[model samples]
Target: MQDILGHLQRLGMSGYEAKAYVALVAAGRPVNGYEVAKRSGVPRSTVYETLGKLVARGAAFEVRGAADATDYRPLPPEALLDRMRREFDGSVDALRDALPAVAGAPEGHLIHNLKDGGALLDRAEDVVAGARRGLVLSVWPQEMARLDGPVRAAAGRGAEVSVMAFGDLGDLGGPRGGERIYEHRYSAPEAVLADLGYRLLVVVGDRREAVVGGFGGDGSAWGIYTADPAVALMAAEYVRQDIALQILAERVGGDELNRLFATDPGLLRLLGRR
Candidate 1:
C-alpha cells in the first residue's frame, strides 16, 4: 500500500516510518529490518534509522533486539492516533501559555485598519448588540434614524437609554407608546448647527465602549474602542459635557441660545473641543 504509506507520510509521518509501519501491517508480525526494507522498498540503512525515529515518536517500537537484528512493529492505529492527538494538544497548551508574551512583543504591531462603510456599520451594530446596561448615542439625524430600533430593543431589555441627538428623533415609539425609549433632544442655534453639526454615535457599557465619530457627512468617519478605565472615564465625561450644553440650549430659546452658546468658549468647552 505505497499510496496509503504516502498518505501517512503527508500526515506528518517520516517517509521511512510510513514504509516500516506498512511493512509491519502487511507482514502481520514483528518483522526484521532487512525484510521491512525489501518489502517496503526502503533502503536497509534508511529502514533502521526510520525505525529508530518511529520508536522515539511512539508510532512503532522494537519488541526484540540483538546485534544487527531488531523485530519492529507498528502500534495499533487507534493508539497511534491517540498519541498524535496528545502531542498536538501538548503543543497547543505550550503555545497558549506563551500567548501573552507573543502578543506583547512590539517588533511588529497591527495598527488601525480601515473598513468600508458597510463593514463599519456592522462593527457598530456588534457593539450595540452586545450592550448590557445602556447606550448613549450622540447622533446626527441620518445616523439616529438607523439606530432607532437597536436603541428600542436595548430599552426593551431594561437598558437605561439616553440619546442627545441632532435633528428630531420624532416619537421613536417612546417608552409610553408600547415601546421602550428614553430620549433627550439637543440642538444648537440654527447658525451654530449650520456651522458644526453633532456627528457622533457612542455606545457605552460597563467595561466596553465604542465611539463612532463623523457620522452622516462626506464619509469622514473614525471610531475607537478601549476597555481601559482611564479612556472610558474620559469618554463618559465628554458625553456628559455635550449633553449638558444641549439641555441648556433647548431651555434658553433660539435668540438666547445663539447669544450664549455661539461664543467659542461656551460651545467649545461643552462639546469637548480642544
Candidate 2:
C-alpha cells in the first residue's frame, strides 16, 4: 500500500491524490469522499478536492452516487499506465526536436573531461573511429589492447595511423602489418609508469582532436578530450617526438641511451625515467 502510494506520487500525484486514488482502486468500485478518506487515511477536509484533481488528470472518473453525493472510480491500471507512457514519449520526442535549435551553435573550442576508465576509453575509441585523415597515438600496452580494433579499423579505411607503444604487445605480429609502429626501448614500461604514477594514453585524430588519459595503479582513471586545435596538435607532436626518439634510440643503440639516461639529470626529468 505504501509502495503503491509512493509510485503514484512519483507519477505526479500529490500525497492526498495518490492515497485517494489508491483507495478508489482498492475499493474496486465507485466510492464516496467519506469512504475514500477513511480507507486512504487522507483528511476528510481535502479528500474531495484531491478526488477532483484525480478526475481532472483522468486517473479517476466522477460518477453519480446515492443522495446526489459524488463518488469516484479509479481508471484501470493498464489503461492509466499506457496513457502515461504515450504522453511521456510524445513529450520526449517534442523536446528532442525543439531543444537543439534553442541550444544554438558551438561557442568555441570544446574540452570535456571523462572521469573513469570506461568513459575515457569510450571517448578514445570514438576519436579513433571517427578519424578520416590520420591518427597519432601513444599507448601503454594495457590500453592498446582495448584500442587495437578501432586502430585497425581506422587504418584499414585508409587513415594514416602511427602508434608509439610502450611495452611489448606480443601477438600483434610486428609492424601491425603496415601502420607506423614505434616500440619504445629506452626504459621498461613499468619503470616509466612508476615514475609517472599512472599509465598515460594519448590519441590524436586528424591533428584536429585528442584524448589524453591517465589510468592509475589504484584503479582510478581520468581523461580529457578536445577539439581544441592547439591541444590536439601538442598531443600529436608529443607522439611524433616519441616516434623520433625511437628512431634516435635505434641509431644510438641501447648502451649509449642507457649512459645518457644515467648521466643526464635533465634527460631523467624529461623522460620521467632513470
Candidate 3:
C-alpha cells in the first residue's frame, strides 16, 4: 500500500488523492465519498474534494445512481499508466519543439557535482553520445563496461575515440569490436589505485566538456561534470599525457620504465611514496 502511494505520488497525485484512488482501486467497485474516507483513512471533509480532483485528472470517474448520491471508481492501473505515458511524451515533444527558441541563452562555464555512481556514469554516457569531434577518457573496466555502447555509437558517427584503461581491459569485459570503436592504451590499475586508494574515471568530450570522478572502497562514488573549457582542457591533457606515457613505456620496455620510476624522485612522490 505504501509503495503504491509512493508511485502514485511520483505520478503527480497528492497524498490524499493517491490514498483515495488506492482505496477505490482496492475496493474494485464504485465507492461513495464516506466509504472511501473510511477505507483510505482520508478525512471525510477532504475525501469528496480529492475524488473530484482524481476525476478531473481522468484517473477516476463519477457514477450517479437514481438517488442524488455519487460514487467513484478508479481507472484501471494499466489504463491510467498508459494515459500518463502519452501525456508525458506529448509534453516532452511539445517542449522540445518550443523551448529552445524561447529559452534564454545559457551563460558560459557550468559545473555540477554528481554524488552517485549511477548518475555520474549517466552523465558520462550523455557526454560521449553528444560528442561530435572526439573523446578522450581514462576509465576503469567497470565504468567502461557501462559506457561502451555510447562510446561505440559516438565513434561510429565519425568521432575519434581514445581510451586509457586502468587494469586489464579483458577483466572489464574485453575489447568491443569495430574499427576505431576504441583506440586503447593499457595502464597498470595498481599504479594509481595504490596511491589514491580508489578508482578514477575521467571523460573529455569534443574538447568542450569533462566529467571526472572516482569510486572508493567504501562504496561511495562522486563526480564533477563541467562545461568549463579550462577544466575540460586539463582533463583532456591528463588523458593525453597518460597515452603519451604508455607509448614511452612501450618504446622503453617495462624494465626500463621501472628503472626510470625508481630513479625519478618527482615521479615517485607523485605515486604517493618512493
Per-candidate Cα lDDT values, in order, are: 0.65, 0.89, 0.85
Q: For candidate 2, give the lDDT.
A: 0.89
Please report the candidate that would top lDDT against the real structure. 2
Q: Cα RMSD to native, each candidate? A: 13.0, 9.5, 5.2
Q: Candidate 1's residue-wise lDDT over 52-158, tens digit each? A: 88888877878875665678988988788787788878987999788877776455322242354555455666666667676565555566556667766766777
Give residue 3's error in model 1 in angstroms: 42
**Model 2 Cα lDDT, one tens digit per residue, 1-274:** 8898888778778999888888888998899999999999999998888888989999999899999978889999999889888988898899989999799688998999998999999999999998989999999878988899889888889999999888877765254644788778866787888889998999999999999999999999999999999999999999898789789889999789778887899998877875
Model 2 residue pairs with clashes: none
Better of 2 and 3 by lDDT: 2
The clash tally of candidate 3 reads: 0
For candidate 3, write residues 104-211 as lDDT tens digits. Answer: 878868899998999999999889988988888888887888987787787788888788877565634345533222223334567578778888899999999999
TM-score of predicted structure 3: 0.68
Question: Distance (Å) between predicted and true CA of 101, model 1?
Answer: 18
Question: Model 3: runs farther than 4 Å from truth?
Answer: 65-68, 113-137, 141-186, 205-207, 218-222, 233-237, 240-274
Supply the TM-score for candidate 1.
0.46
Worst 10 residues of 2 by lDDT: 169-178
